[model samples]
Target: MKEERLFSLRNPWFVVSAGGTALIAILSILVGFVWLPSVHSDFTANGLWGAICSAAGAPSSWYKGGDNVADAPPSNVVVLPPLGIARVNAVSSGRGATLATQRCSMCHGVQSPAGVTAPFLAGQYADVIYKELRDFQSGARQNAIMQPIIASLSDQDMHDVAEYYSSQSRVVQATAADGHDDSVARVLSMQGAPIRNIAPCAACHGVLDRKGAAPWLGGQSAPYLATQLRSFAAGNRHNDIDEQMRNVARQLRPEEIDSLAKYYAAQP
Candidate 1:
């Protein structure tokens, strides 16, 4: 003659089981929607790690937006015929010289002075110079300093400036005062760490072979070069075609970055 329950709603066992199931379901949803996506996004953004993981066929959520490797944007870099050393010298005496004097010399120096806050442009490849200018003007590259200066320049102006700089004599800074051997930097520059998926700096910078629109890094300013490497590593600079610099820079340790900058700065 006990009162019979209509349902299990009042049963302690049933309540516990139902509550546990609800908690499990909520956790599953969070893992699927929130946690998993965040992990995937981080993996994808880590350039060197992503490359390695991708080669190993690790499962990862697809990157959204236009960041997919297969759908990378067309390179804005243009390969121009090499501006011969003689030609650069000749053009530097003309309109190119005028432009450099008026605009570029403030930061880059007139004939490539050493130890400036900005990278020395003298003796840099004309195509490299022109491409950087174009990138700055087109908003492909973001720099608080360069963007405003390049905004008013025409394509022809860029070319003229490039020619002038390419022709000028290169200025070499004194070796790093720290007296470190810099063997690590030399190895990274000449022979990249293949295991880390870093390509040799020489490959693109013309120390070994010249590639399309890659600048000559030899004799660049150490402070400027270090700043740039750090910028690339931190993803603050995204102007490199195909994420080349960004990927390589991120893999470099702080000591390595300092060494590389010093090594290149002292080059002739």
Candidate 2:
């Protein structure tokens, strides 16, 4: 009998094991590098090498000349960390209150009566209010009603008004009568759908972690909130810095939007 080497190709078991391992490696590479990245809308594959490079966290392949370039910044406002931290002074708050009563009361005031869909301004972050006013003034946010009103507001006036709103208490309103449908909204708010790249609503909306300039959603009207979500999803509202809201909104289902809106509206 001839002595046989354990690692030799002549060994049937060795041959089978090696072939199986090779097949698995090939399948993994195909799935991880090609199939996974191809599913995202933004993926730009230059070729096999490009796909591999992107999947491996490497720079674009040398063959990629101008195929997959990033778009320009989407927002005009540059939100700084220190923004919205200013305490409300009596003088500024008083001026802001006067402006709110005279100019903003028609839509935003509590006494506007029922069936109104406009967002309540009370308890909103000052930075959020100021940035939105600036966007309205700059034509970055389009609204026939708001544009003309904001156009005449000076920078100081915007600041005063924002501070005033921030100082006011959140509107005291009735919570949603139905708690059965709210569980979906609560789940979305607390635990986001990671597969869809949607972060938890609480991350930016002040439940878990608050991003700068992100507004407080508690006590807002359900109709107003739902309308805004629809606008964001439809690309009608794109003023959110870095396309953050737009991206999240686009991934949300219509039912999810309704649920989220109702959930926030019910909060105190």
| Top TM-score model | 2
lDDT of 2 by residue, 1-268 (tens): 9988889899998999999999999999777767876785334324556655656778554555868765434568865544444545889889999999888888887332233487788877888888889888887778999998877888889888888887787765665522435776897898876645688999998879899778888778788889999988888887888899888898788888988987887777
RMSD each, Å:
11.7, 6.7
With candidate 2 superimposed using the best TM-score fit, by how many Å does residue 263's alpha carbon deviate from the native? Answer: 1.3
Error of 2 at 60 (Å): 20
TM-score of each: 0.69, 0.73
CA lDDT of every candidate: 0.75, 0.77
Model 1 gets an lDDT of: 0.75
In Å, residue 31's CA in model 1 sits off its true spot by 36
The collision pairs in model 1 are none
How does candidate 1 fare on TM-score? 0.69
The 10-residue segment with the lowest total lDDT in model 2? 40-49
Stretches of candidate 2 off by over 4 Å are 1-10, 22-73, 81-88, 110-115, 175-181
**Count of clashes, each model:** 0, 0
